[model samples]
Target: MSVRHDWYQSESKVVITVLLKNATEKNYAVKIGPKQIHMTADGYELTLSLLHPIVVERSSHKAFPSKVEITLAKETGERWQSLEQKPILVAPTIQTKNWDRLLNEEEKAEEKDAKGEEALNQLFKKIYSSSSPEVQKAMNKSFSESGGTVLSTNWSEVSKEKVTVKPPEGTEFREWEK
Candidate 1:
């Protein structure tokens, strides 16, 4: 469906164009203004209105046509009446179902991660005795160097030694020194 709007300053009127297509194989009757336009398969309806376009579909189960064209006549002193009927009450339940599935997957992933961390901690305690001072010191150093946690087994280059630069004293500066 497409809609186009144009303004005529001289006449102080706006033209609206609406296009609608019926892709069904059967004939359909569409109410346009005071007339009902019958459209066959792949047929279209064109209307002219001075007001903005307001399209209404009678059936919610069937999809509307692919394209429709409408041209709005300029409103003089007469008011245009709408032939559109209220739509049926419907809510988007499919989107809610998909969201629930996503939430379930995320919860399962979190549970798996928690179990993996517990297993890793148990293995670390069994391989290295927690009571040993040397082991504790090594663990502390590792944690400190790794920013308090072993996130991964990957290693990166890190600066370990401190660097210092000293300025030399000249004889010209010694003359002013008290």
Candidate 2:
């Protein structure tokens, strides 16, 4: 059986939505791990080797009449290229299929479908995930210290001085209440 699902990610969590009409809590089972997810519903089994590690203890899910939402807390605040890991190799010979290429193209299509804030966040994540350690550190420091008002990719500038909040032209920046 084939299972249909979709996934999206935030700065700290990855949310997977499985389309399973008529699904119930008692009829479905979801298992989440640091690097994988195994799910079975209505005799349909689906497994995914995650692109990155998650905090299993902090992850959770909920079932609805029309779908299931699984939320995985990321171990790191890095962006995921896809929900599943890329295949390393394919069957050899003339009959060999380019499964990896096909999968990559599909993933690209999914990424392209993202819109608005989600699309922007995904772009930032992709940049951060592929950047150097110094750049990542700069981004984290600047973004955090500036109350999410700034994001700097230049390590030389970010590392040399502290980042200060720069709110919007008409907005005032305030610190979070503890």
Candidate 3:
């Protein structure tokens, strides 16, 4: 039997919604890895080779009575151009799909909170362990002013040691005559 499926993507996650087609949880089996997904529901066998690497520990799925929703968390912040080698799962029910609403507001808020906490913890460790007391104090002040956020900037200087200008030994270097 052929299975029907649907999919949607977000900035940091991909949501794969499989059409249950009246299948129950007990009738389905799923295998998920860092770069692939295999699912057998009812009489259909579906496979997906992910377009990019994902955090297996952070990805999850829920088999509801009418559908199975899989949430994949990307390891990097890059947006995915596609989910699999082929186009998304073919399903006649895509017209009924709610593509915009993946996670509810509360769920999104919780994710933001967890990510913020982790970033702050990492920043704290770096500040306390690597910085002098004065530098640490400055970082704390910056964080306070920025509401505990860090904006990355392209702030860098060319290495003087790597820059060199040498005239060719054989070729006479002459200035252009005006």
lDDT of each: 0.40, 0.90, 0.71
Give the winner by TM-score: 1 or 3: 3
What lDDT score is found at residue 66 in candidate 1?
Answer: 54
Name the better of 1 and 2 by TM-score. 2
**What lDDT tens digits, residue by residue, belong to model 1 across residues 19-81?**
334434435333444323333333443333323332233211132465333332333434344
The TM-scores of all predictions, comma-separated, are 0.34, 0.49, 0.45
> Once model 3 is optimally superposed onto the true structure by TM-score, how far is the C-alpha of residue 83 displaced, in angstroms?
0.7
- Tell me the deviation in Å of residue 19 in model 3: 0.6
Return the clash pairs for model 2, or none. Answer: none
Please provide, for model 3 over 87-126, each residue's C-alpha lDDT reduced to its tens digit, 9 standing for 90 to 100. Answer: 5667765456454575576689899999999999898687
Give the lDDT of residue 69 in candidate 3.
Answer: 86
Q: Put the candidates in lDDT order, highest first.
A: 2, 3, 1
Q: Tell me the spans in candidate 3 whose CA falls farther than 4 Å from its real position.
A: 86-178
